[model samples]
Structures are given as structure tokens and as C-alpha cells.
Target: MNIFLVPYTRWRHLAMALWCGGFGLMAWWLVLALTVVGGPKWAPEWDGPILLGTIAAFVSGGSILGEDNLRRTPILKRLLRGVIAVVIAVANTLIWYWLLQLVIPKLLPDAWSADAADASLVSLRYRVGDFLAGGLATGIACAFVRKFDHVVSHVAGGISSALAAGAAWYLLGSNFQGLTDLYLSGAALGLVWGFLFGLITWPIPDSLYTGWIRVLSAVRFGRRIPVDAPDGGPKERFVGHFPRGLDLFLPADQGVAEMHVSVAVDGRGRYAARGLSLAPTRVKRFLERVDIRYDPRRPAPLETALSSGDRILLGEGEHQAELEFIMLPKEEM
Candidate 1:
């Protein structure tokens, strides 16, 4: 039996994961601060009406900005995109809270007492609803700012909204019952945090997106034929099982020889392949090193065979040579 592994490479995916994970950690810390550390110091005063309004403002503002920054869209588009994001986030938060309320107590009865569990369940629902309303309102406010037609004013509005939201959350802590409410209350807290944090971090997505797009565009390569024989005859093609777009090409006449192929993109964005032939090897050894780049765009299969040579340029014209070749896509191999 023979096993082949395909080479995979995608820098964009890695960058996106890192960016999202980094912000997620910060969001977690904010929740911990408001619920565990601040406690009574942040709760609302006797004027419930004023406190509630403040909380609403912060929650909505944070949610709008946070989601907009993440999506790499202009704040001016907040009405459409921000509202949609808030609805989705709220729905997801509510579903998560409801599921946890039903499943958590049973899973860890010792962790939560009967009365504590009941209070938590109720508190969670209220927190989810409050956060949803806040997010919606904040998004609406941002929509108005979009009409201003200046980046500076838009940013100032975002900053003001975030500060207002944060202050609101700090004053209305009583609306959220206790630590049990944290799970549901976290979204509301996120609303405030997102608004403030989002304003501060607003420029990040633009810069990051610009840099990321340039790098990806530079590295990308279009489909090209991998030729082994000049005239193109009975050639063997070997494919690897990798789903990503990576392949190798070996020309005929190098009997049982190995090749070291290094691929890179030039300033022009064309993929340049440098092939270095290796010493003769047994059947098993030959199979280990040799791989192919399977391109779906091409009508014919691309295959490569190792030969006795120091280095060979793939695109350079060479005389036709008779050779047996096998073609296989990376995934199938």
C-alpha cells in the first residue's frame, strides 16, 4: 500500500483566526471586570428610568461598532449590516442561554443550588432581551452618523456612543441580578465594550484588510500546464490528496532521480518553480518525495517524473522526449 500527502498553504485563513481569537479574549476580560470585580460599585442608582436608558445606549452602540469593525465595512453602512448582525447575535445569545439553563443545572447540580438555578434562568432571559434592544438602538444611532459624510465625524460619533454605552452599563448593574446572570448579561456588557473598543479599534480592520488583500493577491497563482515532454506524449501523472492548490511537475529522462522543487511568487504574481534533481532512489523512496500540482482549470492532467539533473526551469522550452507518466490530483493521491 502507498500513502501520499498533499501540501496545503493559506496565509489568509491563519490571519483571520488570530484576529478573531485575540479580540474574543479581550471581550472575555471585560465581562469578568463588570460582573466579578466591579459588582455593587457599577450597579444602577434609584432612578431606574435613567439607568435603563443609559444601559440601552451603551449596549446598542458597542454591538454596532464591534460587528462593523469585524466585517471590515464602513460605519455608514451600519443600518443594514449592523442591524442584521445585532439580530443574529441576539438570537444566538438567547438560544445559547436557554439551552444552557436547561442543560447546565442537570450537568452540574452541585455547582448551582435549586434557588440559585431558578433565579439564574430568569435573569438570563431578561439580560438577553435587554442586550438585544440596546444593540438595535445603538445601530439606529450609528445609521444617523453615516449621513454626516465625513470620516472624522463618524469616528467621533462612534467614540461618543461607546463612552455613553459604557457609562450606562456601569450604572445599571442591578438590572442584571448576579453572577448567575453573567452568562446572559455578558452580551449586554459586550455591547458596551464593543462600542468603546470598536471605536478605538475601528481603523484596525481597514489597515489589516488592505495588508491582507495585498499579500493574498501577491501570492495567488493562476492555472498553468506542467509539462514533462516538449511535444506532450504518453506521460505519467501522479496526484496527491491535498485539497488546496499545490502541485509538482517532473519531466522525463531523469531515470529514478529525485528533485527539490521550491515554488515562490515573483513581484509580477507569477508562480516560479525551481526544480533540483536528486540521486537515484528505490521505488519506495521515489514515491516519498515526488508530488504533483492538480489544477482543475486545465483540460489535461499534470504530472512530473524525477530525472538526473542539477536544476530545470519548468516553462523553458526543451526538446521532445519519450517518457511514461502518471497523472493524479492531490486529493486522490
Candidate 2:
């Protein structure tokens, strides 16, 4: 249970943690405000520490990497990373809050609670308690659930976990009415935020690499461009290019005999290029990062295999596109 075992540099990890807080705060308020306006009077206000905790566990491929690590770990040693993250998220967030209070008191005083001015240890205890309560309840709720698929699925889990936590707090004769809203808003927003964040950072991994044949030299939008250029966007090729559809329309590269080359991105993130064109599609592979080598004159038959940093020439002359095999890494998947 080495809680401090982070693989990355401290500053960068802390930066990302603080970056996560921006989205977390948004998630907390959006749910609370939406529920308060249209729903029951007893709904809970945003649970700040819980929001931070949940964000820390899940964002930016952290949870996915964690899950993979857990699976690779021996069965007896597996622990709930989500739970541990809850503590870390709260601790880090509170530290950030403390700094904000000290550094920007006159300008950002409204951001801090009255408790922020209280004795340091007491403030820490309150925040820690706030995180633990939600963390335990959310972890329990999530354990009984499966991975989220649809947007509604996120909403459901949020409500369920919030209610579960809120009920516990209510029985303690704390704010019972507040728990009602807390349960609903927290559940709904948690799911929604997770879903949105996934899209924002579509982390495509190196292993499950969906590759593309990028144009290194091309004549497009009016000029003969020479040099490998980045694509307009990532093309997740379920089906490689053809004349009809599911492709990038390469009309200029007539040297590419229609259906010039067929590419299949394999399971291990490798791209296998087979020559579909009657004309030999030259698959020039770069050797030792210096020399260029040919792949069997290729590709009037299956010839080239391209990984990261590899290149291909689909056609000759005006229709020529100097192509590269491009892949998004595991972190960006």
C-alpha cells in the first residue's frame, strides 16, 4: 500500500490533478444548480471533496491504467484503487484550497468557506470526513454496477451512489433534506461528467492502434505539398479506403490504381499493407532511421508492413502521396 508510488514527476502529476479539478467543479455545480431549479427542495448542495475524489480516480486514462495494473497484479494483492484515489483527491484538493485562501484572499475570498479560516487541523478533518463519506458510498455503489455505456447509465449510478451516501448522513440526524438532493444531483452529474471527459480526451492506446495512411507529400487545396503533414483529424479506420466509401478520397494520386492498397490495422497496433492495385505500389520502409529499403516492389500484392514512423507511396506522379503509418498512443486512446 505505497500510496506515494506515482510513476510520473511530481510537478506534472500535480498539474494534471489541479486541471482535473476544473472539470470536477463544473460537474458539481451543474448538477446542483440543475436539480435545485427544477426539482425537490431537499436536494443536497454539491459535495466538494467527493467531486474531487471521483475525478482523481477516473480522469485522463488514470482509471484504465489502474485497472490494467490491478489485473496484472497478483489476485491476493488487488485493492480498490478508486477508494485510495478518493483520499488522494481530497488531500490534494484541500491543499489547493488552502493555497488559494492564503495567496488570493482579497481577490478570491468568496471561493473559500468560513471553515477555511479555522484552525488548520480542524479544517483538514472536516474535508477528510467529507471525502471518506462519499468515497465509501460511491465505491460500494460502483462495485455492484458494471462499466458505464450510455449517458443515462452514468446518471443512474450518480443518483444511486448519492442516495446511498445521503441516507447514511441523514440517519445520523444531519441535514436529511439536503441528502435528498445530494443523492439525485450527485449521481446524475457524476455520470454525465465522466462521459463528457472521455470524449474530450479520447485516449487511443499504442497497442490497440487504429492507424492511418497520412499524406507526406500531396497536391491538395491548391498546391503540391512536399513533406509529411499532420492529418485534419484521426481516421479510425474500421474499413480501409475504397472508391465508394469508408475512405479518404485520393483522386489526384492516379498512380494509385483504384483500390491501390488495402490496409489492415492489427490487434497489436501494427499496420499490414497489402497491394490491391495492379500497379506495383512501392512500400519504401525506412531502415535504421537513415536508409530507405523497398518491400518486394510491393503491393501489386501484399508487401508492406508499417508501424509508427514507417512510410508508404500509394501512387506515382500527380497522384503521389508520401504516406506514413500514424497511431495514437495508449494514453490518448
Candidate 3:
């Protein structure tokens, strides 16, 4: 059988591998610390949260790194900033978990360990609980670490695989269990469990994630105002290229005045308008406000439309008006 060590380019794969390895080791260490220093009695029960929090911190750090890189920030400076951000995240997690531990004793009396003797059953149940709790914690963490979702997912998968392998080794012992037998059994069980778990908790769609980011960006930076048309009529229509599934980002109060506006349909498709128009330059400035989407499949200069109410007229035209517009790339619109 052919083995595919890494799928992406060498540099990319190396960077990803290093990031994952570093983060995975951090997670392992955190788990170990919780068990060893935090007290094993509580460790077994809190293992999921500790590991999940560690993963969250890694992802949050990676996201900060990625965002800095995307904004054309210097690599060395970005790296330093990311490291600082990660340290803060780690400290936050530790504090949060510590507080949770304090609160748990007051809330639930039996939120801790079970002294069951059936080794296999206990491990199996603990594993299942860990998987569920870890997955949930990871999902929540993903919300904060949106930029590094792909990397985080890959790292999480790798760590989970390693843990499974360790469990299998413990189960089979040193007896010359055929390597092939071990691999097949392990692979099968992993697949079954993964599939079952995935079915139970469906993942968030890519579009929804992007939409949330866009909404958050808008809230942070404020909305874009477009340039008005020459005739002084309200610039009721907005047209722009936006990422698919981001239509949710469009405000609901701003009705879709029209569908398939001629400007958008002429050559490149344009997203319809909804909001107000300010100045053309302001529109351009607003467009640059955030990384709306990251899709390589589409073209450049994505467009965004504005309503007549939003338009700030520069000059009137016989039929044409100077309107503020954001040219979004086909990929990001």
C-alpha cells in the first residue's frame, strides 16, 4: 500500500506538522499536569476539559498568527505577537479551569471519578466521555480560534489517533499480536467510533462560520456606506461578490430590493445591495476592513452594493451617479 506522509507542499506540510506537534505536546503535557499536579482523583474527570482547553489555546494562538500573516504583518513580529497571545490564552484557560473546579464542588457532588473495577468498561466509558466532552470543548474553542480551524482539526485528529493507538497497545500487551491484526482492529474501531460520534454531533458548515465572522467584523468596525448615484435617487441596490453561505451576513431589515441587478449580471456577478451609501472612497476603505472570506477558487475585486439611503452623492449624472462601491474578489464575495 502506498503511504501518503503529507498531502500539501513540503514547506506547508512541515509548518503544519511542526505546529501540530508542538500543540499536541502542549496538550499532552497539560493533561499530564492535571493528572499529576492537579491531583489524579480530579484529573480523570477533568482530563477532557484540560485537553480541550489546551487545544483551544493552541488554536487561538495559531489564529492570531494567521490573522497577522494575512494582514501583511512582518513574519517575525507576527510570530512574537502570536507567542504573546498564546501565553495569555494559556493563562486564561488555567484560570478558567481553576474557577470551574472551585464551582463544581458547590454545584455537583459526584462530577468526579468512578471507582468501577471493570478495566475495559471503565476505560471505554471514560474514553467515550472524554471524546464527547473534548469534542464540545474543542467546538467552543473553535469559535474563538476561527482562523485556524483547519489546522486545529488536523491536530485534534492526530492527537486522537495517537491516544487510540496508545490505548490499543495497553490492551494487546507485548504478546506478538500480529502487526497487521493490530492495525486492522485499531483502524476499524476508530472508524466506527468516529463515524458514530460525528453523526451524533454534526459540524458547523463553512458558510455559517464565515457569516459569523463577517457579522463580528461589521460589529467591530462598523458598516460600509456607499457613494450615491448621479440622479440623486437613493442607492437602493447593493452589488458585490461575497463568499457563498455568507448571505446571512446581509442585514434582515435591509430588504433585497431587487434580484439579478443588471450591473451584477453584466459580466461578473454582483451581490445585491442593502445598506446605506457614504462616499466612494469610504466604501473602498470599508471593503478593506476585514478578510471576509478565504477562497482561492473565485476571481478578484469582489463587489458590494448599497441602498439609496446609504449613498452619499459626489456628483449628479444624466443617468449615472458616483456611488461608493467595494470591489470584492469573486472568491470572497
Candidate 4:
């Protein structure tokens, strides 16, 4: 669904940000508290970025695999997927941060050398470095965690995260002198980044052009099946009772056929539902509100275009499958 148009979505967006932000604040506080005990000599400078990147990785990764829509997936599979996403996100983030540390100094040598430039100039350069590192790391990490393989989705995610990092650095740059200051800065940056991430990603076109099919019948009520393909190619999800190749698996009862209908999303993000069997497949179009039935017994099978909120009835009895086509607002996918 286009979540932004729903009344509850705003609150959901805020709740997501607050949850991530709270974790960010807690992480920052714990890291700062650790500094008071006096760690290894080289640890102080690296701790904040490391913790920030780690928490941001969790936030980004969690948003994908932990989505409400994916709840129907097996618990073990979901946990495994979540762990994999974490590993990739954290590893990618750390690698990018390390690269930035190595490259930024070389690119802005004057920023690192106190004797070569004014202290303010050096501070400004370091801030710039922070901005670039934070932005690029988070952006690239998000791309790694997302499911779909779309250039627009990747670029949008990267740019949104980069913007979040830049804004965070800009807002909280001046207060890094002491542990308390560092904690405050880190917490604020995390909070700001979470909100900005949500703001940019929640309503953008990259988030909205995809959708899923939800089973509303008694047999498989509340089952959500994704309609889009990862590679942006047309992938038909077969609906049937045979089980092995079907996307929307249904029990073999009443009038359901083996290969009932096929649903797919084209490259341009349009949805099409095609009848595959001689079963009574019907569609109640969203715009017209008219009931249209597809007769697979015809010489040429026909496919009907679907819009958000379109309803499809696979049969006419108690065993019939009621499917609702819902357009999704883009997030991680």
C-alpha cells in the first residue's frame, strides 16, 4: 500500500525513527561511558564512528527483513536472513569508514596537519570528512541490504543516506570536545539520521512503484505475496494447488485448478494478471468496479491489467481464493 496516504503511516514513520533513535542514543551513551575507563591509546578516536556505523547498520538492516509484511515467512528463515543482512551491512559500513580514514587525510593533508593550516580550517576539513564518510558508508550499506536489484533504488538509498549523514554532521559538528559532548553529538546525529532516512525513503517514487498480492480468502487469509522481481524483469508468479512451482499456493479443494492464474509486474512497474486454466478467474477492477472474468478455454488466453486495491476471485464458492492487489510504498525493497 501507499503508506504515506494512510493516516497511520505518519505515526508509524515517527515510531520507526524514535525506535532507531533511541537505540542510537543508548549506543552512544554506552560507548562514551566506556571511554571514561580509559581504553587503548588509539581507541578513543575510532570509537564514535565505529559505534555510529554499527547502530546505523542495525537500523538499516532491520527495516528490511523485519518489515511487518514479511511476517508470514518462516521464523528460522527470517532470523537467518536478518543475520546475513547484519553481517553484510556492518562489514560494508566498516570497510567504507576505513577507506575514508585512509583516503580523506591524503586528499586533505592540510586538514590533518595542525601546523600547516589554521585550526578552524582543519576542523572544517575534518567535518567535511565526517560528512562524506558517514553519508557514503550508510548509503552504500543500505544498497547492500536491500532486496531488489534496481539502479534507481540503489542510487536513491545511497543519496538519502549521504544527505542524512551530511545533515547530521552539519547540525552536530561543533560539539566534540569532551565525552559528554561526543555523546550528545553522536546521539543527535543518529536521531537526525534516522528521521531523515525515513523522510526521504518513505514517500519517494522508488518506494511507491511496487506492490504485492494479499490473500483475503478463508483458506489463506492474510498471506502476502510479492509481485515484483529482484532483477526488474517480468517474473510471473503462478497461482495454483500443485505446490512446487506456484507462487500463491492454495489447497486443492472446491474448483481451484493446478495452474489457475499468473500475476506479474512488468519492467515499467505495471501489474498484469493472466488466466492460466479453465477455472473461473474473475477480477473486480479498481477504477471500473466491474466484474470481468477471464475464460482460459478461449483460443487465446487474456491478461487483465491491475491497479492498487483491485480484487481477484479465483473461484465462486467457499473454497474460492480472494486476492487483493495492493500497491506498496517503497522502503528497503
Candidate 5:
């Protein structure tokens, strides 16, 4: 199984969000305590609060899990991603502060109060900044984890994060002025935000697992066995007749064994089919229509690389079952 591209479920996503938010509450307390003890006394009035919120965003962005629970992503790489998140969070905090607190007030003199420094924490400008900052940070963080190449995935992450941040800011009354607010609204906001983030950005059963085995000329013609494994971890399917335990259950009378054939995607993203049944599975590639029999006794493994539109014949005579492999386009993911 390829660990990197494993699909992410909704429950896992919500769980991750909770983890981040729980950490966020503690992070707020830690940052506040540090500010009171050693932070610059002459720092701007908004500095401490902004830093606290930014750190919360850092937690949410950095704690996002890309792979499934069974696999362990390298700790060093995850830390590097966290550091990148910190940089993004810090930069966003400064930029938004400058725009909303300094520039916007001067630009809209009548709309903004003269003492903008004393503006309400629930102000519209602050909320807007929160939305933009949260979105940008989340998008970049997801892209970094996905190897910085999946444009659609990152875009989805940005939109979801932005919406989550905006909703939290608006619904929670936009203030973290007290410990009560920090713990209550903070944890609630994290739960809601993380769920939304996962809803849109979580991986699907596409990419390497994007295919299906369709019954061609069998008793159950047109039946489909999806390429995705149970729980979306391994990109392999076990075709058999033993009922519930198999990935693809076929009729036993059709020359299929308890484990007939195993189709899987290798680490290099190539699909291969291995014959397991003593009944000799026959494969015909998409490019070549001639039948090729798997020889398990040979030094080479009894397997063949599969392509879209390939066919696998499972039995002999009128009782034979033919299954066709159909691969979907990855771009659709």
C-alpha cells in the first residue's frame, strides 16, 4: 500500500480539528503568560492578542494530518511544516494589523473611530482579516504537505479554512479577552473549524485508487468492484468467493478460488494483477488483445501490469467469468 496517498475520512478530520483546538486553548494561556512575564512592555496594544490568535491558527494549520492513522509521517518534516505555518501566521498577523488597524482607519476616517486602537474586537475589519489570514495559512499548509503541486487541493483547503475562520469570528462574538472566552469559544471554534476544513480538504478515494473492476461476460455482468480497499488504506482488492472477508466476492462456480486474484497499485503508482487461484487467470492488456497466462512456477512473479480497459478472464468454457479493469482520470480528483 502507498501510505502517502491514503484517503482521509470525515471522522478522522473532525478528530484532528479537535486535537488542534484543544492545543490552541492551552497555547493561548501559554502565550498570555509569556507576554505578562517577558514580552515587550511597550508593545502595541493589539500585539499580544494578535500573537495569541496567530498561534492558534498555527496549531490548526500545522496539526493537520495528511495520511491515515496506520502510517507515521516523519516528525522532522512535520516540524518543518509547522515552522512554515508559524512564519505564515506571523506574517499574516502583521499584515492584517497594519491594514485593518493602521491603514483602513486612516482611509475611512468617518467610518472608523479616531481611536481605532480602542476599537471593538468584534469589528468587521478584524473579521475580514481573520478570514483572509486563516484561508491563506491553511491553503499554503495543505499545499506544503501535498508536496506543493496539487493546486485544486490547496484551493479547497483555503476556501474551507477561510469560511471556518469567518464563521467562528462572527458567531463567537470575535473576542478572546478573558480566560472564560478563551477556553469556551476557543474550543468550540476549533471543533467547528476543523470539521469544515476536513469536509472540503480531506482526501478522497481517487488518485492511485481511482479505478474499478467491472464484470464483463459473467453471471453478474456489469458488476463493479471498486479499486479502493476497506477503509481506504491499501490500494488493493482481493477477488474471491468466501463471502464477507474478501474485497471482491465472486461466484465460486466461475473458477474463482477463495482468493482468486489480487490487484494492487505499487509505490510507483502502477497497477499490477497477481494470480493466486490454481485455476490460472488469463489477462489481456489494453494495448494487446492476446491472452497472457500467469506462470507462478517461473522465477518471475506471476503478475502483469494493468492498464485501463484491460480484461481478465477468470474461468474456462461457458461458465467463465470475464472482468474488465477501468481506470478513471486522475485530474478529476
Candidate 6:
């Protein structure tokens, strides 16, 4: 019923909801009580709701989704996803809360005037609307999670979070009345939640891997390729013209395709690569040209088991692209 239901909400959230919600609620009330009892009046009482809400949102929002998809994901990649999820969730919650504040008063003016009518009480109608709006907006935010390496996915998350918040705010009529107040409160909540989640989830960059590609050209460029692959998994990849996709690139003059060759793991977990090049891909060594037997019927693609120091030249003519596989031991790596 809460925003928790938005992202493929299944039985997965029930226990988490109970556990996190209970601690979060208690944590929130404690902060409020302590602040009001002895702390300075300058301290905001809403801090309780923000902290409590952040726990429910953070753990439930990004953390839960990440758990669902953690299979085969590298640690660093997982950290990035969690950070993105937390930020988006927090943005959605704050936006929904602020907007509900403005809208409730407008839709049911009678309720507002009567509550405002009492002069001594805040309207319960607004509270109900705020709760509903928060849940709905949270759901909307959770739907945007995507693959972390994707540039567009991150951009979409940020844009969607901002827009979802705005839409919720507009619905609540937060724009006209107390917009400044809502912005200030929302900004504070976002920063606080963002900082806390960052520390708890992704304290370090634990998923990145580095490797140097020895390019075979006149001035051989040692292009650095950072590969993120699970251990014992096939080093699946493609190599071609830009040399970028090859896990190593080649010179443009060779007329290499975007994916000139394919290297994939076999059923036995051994790697095999064959030239997918439309142009001649036979090479003697690092960059030397070799006249390999050509079978015009199938382009004579040679699929062979690969290992450390396997050198193959791709392409024919004056200048052939060179490819060298350098396997570093885990300790050296």
C-alpha cells in the first residue's frame, strides 16, 4: 500500500517493511524527542520523519532492488547501482512530501479552513494526502533503475527523480503556497539522506579492474582497458576498427569492422576467437602480414583456443591490425 509496492513489489518487502519500519519509526521519534527535550529550538522537528523515512526508503528502495539483481554483478558496479537507487528514492520522497503539503489545502478547502478554522490544529486531511502521495511517488522513482555502466540510465534516473518530485509537488499545489519552505525542507532531507546512504552502501570503489593493451602500430599505443568480469566466466568480447571494442583497438587504415572478431567462452569454459572481419584478418605475429589459407566459402575463419601470449594479425594488404593477448597472473594483476 505504501510506495514500497512500486518496484515489482512482491512478498520480498513485507518482512523488510516490518523490520526497517519499526526501527526507523523508533529512531525517528527518538531524534525528535531528544531535539525538543534538551536541544536548541533551532533544531527542526521534521528531522525525525526525514531520518525514519530515509531508512525505510533507502533500505527498501535501492538496497532491495540491488539484492534482487546482485547475481554476477561486480562489487564496484553494485555500489554504483545502490548509490543511484538511494539518490533517486530520496528525491522522489521529498518531492512527493513537499507537493502534498501544498495540494491538500487546495483540493479540500473546507477541510483546511475547518482545521485552520480551529486555529490551534493542523489538518489531518493533508497528512493523509501526503502519505498517499509519498507512496505513489516512491513507486514511480523505483521504476527507473537500469544497468549502471549505461550512461543514459544514470541520466534518466536523475531527470526522472526531479520530474517525479515536481509532478507530485504540482499536484499538491506546493508551487503557490509555501514553495520556499518546501524547497528548503526537501533540500535538507535530500542532502542528509544522500550522505548517509553513500556511507552505508558504497563506502569504497571495490569493483574496478585494470589492464594494459599492447597495440601493434608504428608507435604501439598501450591502451588501458578496464574489464569487469566475474571470475571463471568467459571473457566474452569483440575487437575491430576503433580497437575499442576489441579489449584492444587497431589502426583505422586496416578497414576493420566495429566488431571484426568475436572471442567467447565455450561449453568447457575455454575461450575461442575467430576473425569476423570482412577484410583479410590473417597476420603473422604482433603486426606482421601472413598469407593464411583462405576458404572463400566461409571467409576461412579460424576458431582456436586462446591462452597467454597468443598473437594474431587481423586483415591483409599493406597494413594489417595486430592483436596480442597478455594474460597477467592474479597476483601481478
Candidate 4 lDDT over 1-333, as tens digits, reads: 124443323344554445445544554565555655755344445653566566556555544443433234566776676566566656666676666666656665574544322323424335454445554555455455455445365446544654565455545656434323444556666566655554444333333446788888788789887888877777778888887967888887845788887788777877788877767888886355433345636775677888777888887767677888876644425
Return the top candidate by lDDT.
4
Clashes of 2: 15
lDDT of 3 at 297: 55
Task: List the candidates ranked by lDDT, beginning with the highest.
Answer: 4, 5, 6, 2, 3, 1
The lDDT for every candidate, in the order shown, is: 0.35, 0.41, 0.36, 0.59, 0.58, 0.45
Positional deviation of residue 232's Cα in model 6 after best superposition, in angstroms: 18
Over 4 Å off in model 2, which ranges? 1-80, 84-209, 221-246, 252-254, 288-300, 317-319, 329-333
Model 1 clash count equals 25
lDDT of 5 by residue, 207-243 (tens): 4335678888747787886675444455877787888
Error of 1 at 126 (Å): 20
2 against 3, candidate with superior lDDT: 2
Position 56, candidate 1: lDDT: 35
lDDT of 3 by residue, 222-320 (tens): 443322233323333333223242222232222212121111221122233322222121222333422222133555433444321222222113311
Clashing pairs in 4: 207-329, 207-330, 208-330
RMSD of each: 16.6, 16.1, 16.8, 9.6, 11.1, 16.6
* Tens-digit lDDT track of model 6 for 218-312: 53455534222456444556666563435655556765566676556543445455666556655343454444323457746756655445565
Model 2: lDDT of residue 70: 23
Q: lDDT (0-100) at residue 25 of candidate 2?
A: 45
Candidate 3 vs 6: which has more TM-score: 6
lDDT of 2 by residue, 1-333 (tens): 111232222232332233333444455565456557866343122335435444434432243333344235454333454444444444544555445445543543455544544434232323443433333333333332224334253334433333333333333333544444435444434443344333223222233223445666644322211112133232223112355864444553445444555556443444566655555466665442312223457543444556655666655566566556655322222
